[model samples]
Target chain A: MADPAGAPCVEVVDLHKRFGALEVLRGVSFAVDRGSVVSIIGASGSGKSTLLRCINYLEQPTSGEVRIDGEPIGIERRADGSERRRSMREIGRFRRDLGMVFQQFNLWPHLTVLGNVVEAPIRVRGLPRRQAMELARACLERVQLSEKSSEYPARLSGGQQQRVAIARALAMQPKVMLFDEATSSLDPELTGEVLEVMRGLAVDGTTMIVVTHEMGFAREVSDRVIFLHGGLIEEEGPPAQVFGTPRSERCRQFLAKLLH
Target chain B: MGNWERLVWNQRNVLLDGFLVTLEICAIAFAVAVAAGLGLALLRLYVRPLRWPAIMWIEYCRATPIYVQLMWVNYVWPEILGWPTTFYTAGWVALALQSSGYLAETFRTGIENIGRGQREAAYAVGMSPLLTFRRIILPQVLVTIAPSIVTQFTVIVKSSTLVSVITVQDLMFQSQRLVNVWFEPIEILTATAAIYILFIFAVSAAGKALADRLRLRYGLGT
Candidate 1:
């Protein structure tokens, strides 16, 4: 379902993050409308992962606010205008509404494929084991990995592991999904399987923020494309305008080198 | 000459008594070490600032000889506290604490080796930190560090001999008494060494077999 106008699902306002002396995200700001796919593309160390992490409050920002569904993500401001950091317990509850898939498949190797999908729904969400297993089966089916449920993650191929990772996240029924280079670790042939799963998510209208290097996927699946450079949003627009008629020399150079 | 042969032949009783004591120490120390090590490893997992301090504690215990720690626990702890600490309890406590340091370092390495993504995936699904560790992180750690943990356990078994210094009457202690009374140092010492070697070999075999079973069950290997 489409959200009403001016009701953004995610909003990052002047976010700044620093590690020692290096500022990884410098005044980064963006808003993701509900039920839309926004792809962030950039070279390595361009703060793409940092931005995604900041959205979920995984990495606390040096200064700025992240609001999800109009609620502040990680801080509570009091009547005195003083702010308090959110507790881990509170953050965990907030994260239930958001799911993140990493570059690595990140399946718990000791657990079976079904265990990986069933664990969070049962433990975190407090669903009954029977109901959680039912949900897990449905998610596995969506990823076309239902038959591999009893197998361990170490036995799966890179493509299959990534798909299982996707299924594990989907079982949570998150309102927003964040992907950080989700297909970068796989071989060319394997990358297609993960990308296909992601395409399926987009087609199903899952709200998503994808950080990727796959230009074609960005062109095809993204409703808006954001190009970040040196920890700043260098340019952003619809794919047709950004990819076809680039605005900045950096974007054009990036596109030229990448497309070639 | 016949009488002398009979005296030495009765060494089987000594071996049996020592074996029981050795088992007691190893079992108690291993349980304590794993429990304490798990706590320290979780500290290392979340708090980067605590990592070095935890390392220092582990290294300190490892660097000081186990025998010396046993002596201190037996002789010094009661004196300092002005309370009753029995030799038996002291022996187990010293060994357990020493093993804790080594096991803590091993567990930390296992937890760190697990990719950050694994924990993130758990977090993304809204898992509490304790739940995440219990369900996701700890299981992977068990698989990743099983070999090292088993090796350390065998080492703990051997180290139990040090408890003899604290008058624990363990295998080595009994061997020493037999050596003193018999005046057959060469023969008695050799037998003692042989028994220890045999015991350790059995433990090593058991550990390898356990690891194989776990790997097969978890599908970690083909």
Candidate 2:
């Protein structure tokens, strides 16, 4: 869906997340323009996943803000200069606009592929069952899993399950799709199919923020590349500039290590 | 053999009547236990202010002996609360209290066993915490804990025998009445024990079969 012109589809301002004594994200900030793909690349524990999770308020940021479609989520700022966490219902309303795909392909094992795709549309969006089914079929076809609609996730391979997961998110028609290492758990052979579906989404102008280790996909598909080191953005630019000639030594070294 | 025919077969009508009462009490207790147990477990897990009270109740039910609980509910509850005016009400209520504790713990474990990722996934799709619990968590938990739930039902049936002490006239009460009438403790007592054993065996067997079928049909098992 098109966002109003000139407004970023998603924005994060000074996002900082702390887990008790451990501060996982420190002053991280970014934005995703509508119809653009941004890839966040980093080593393990660089807070890439945490940043993605905070965008959806799956893990609340200790401080700072995340906004989707220009509306601040999870925390509300009152006129008296007080900040209060929004109620879960309020947060849920905002979350419905952003679809997230997990690294683990966390499909509900009890539901069929079609059921998984249609559940939120019927329940959260309150679409009638027939309409939800039609939307689900279209999403299933987008991921090329229409033939496996009635099959349970347990019967599918890792790649097939991940595609079904992508379809589930796509069914929501979220403003921006967030992928948290969506194919990291797949076998090397199986990663291709899942990535192909994501590539199709990217080509069709879906706004996406991907936290990933897939260097090739990041370099080729993403319009912009962000390199995260520790808990902050180290280097970011168009993919060619960031990958070919990184200004930061750490970014260059990380890319070299991965390339080797 | 003559003793058997005279004591067991000859009094089959009375024994059947008593058995019907036992069935009624057990069924009522079980239904209440399941509903209350789920409520208690949810309160403990989700309701911040009431968590301690729910936990204390579960502990009390689990710790008290069934015979003691039956006696306390039958004698003390009517005096203190001015309710459960009949012995039968007291009987099922007491049985339900004990099993609800065990069932609450069973349900808690089942809920905890679900992966955190499952919950996050539900939330990501915009389902509220309550919706997630009902649609995503509860279905899987029920499938995973079907065997444990069946075991709790069997426990309820076995513990139900304690209600007879409060003059509820279940199968145990009727059989003991026959023993007191004839004063031939041997045939009546042995037959009563056999009947109790056979009934419990049948219940557990049927419960196990149903649970296994559910597990096969809906479980994560491949």
* TM-score of chain B in each prediction: 0.87, 0.94
Clashing pairs counted in every model = 0, 0
Give the candidate number with the greatest lDDT.
2
lDDT of 1 by residue, A91-130 (tens): 8887988888888878888889999999989898999999
> Candidate 2, residue A116: CA error in Å?
1.4
Candidate 2 chain A minimal-lDDT segment of 10 residues: A1-10
| Clash-forming residue pairs, model 1 | none
- Candidate 1, which CAPRI tier? medium
Candidate 1 whole-model C-alpha lDDT, 0 to 1:
0.86
Against the true structure, whose TM-score is highest? 2
DockQ score of the complex predicted as candidate 2: 0.69
- Tell me the tens digit of each residue's lDDT in model 1 across B1-222: 553454445787886798788888888888888888887766666778898787777777778888888877788888998533777788888888888888888888888777777778888888888888888878878876787777888888888888887788888888888888877777667777888899889888887887888887666423
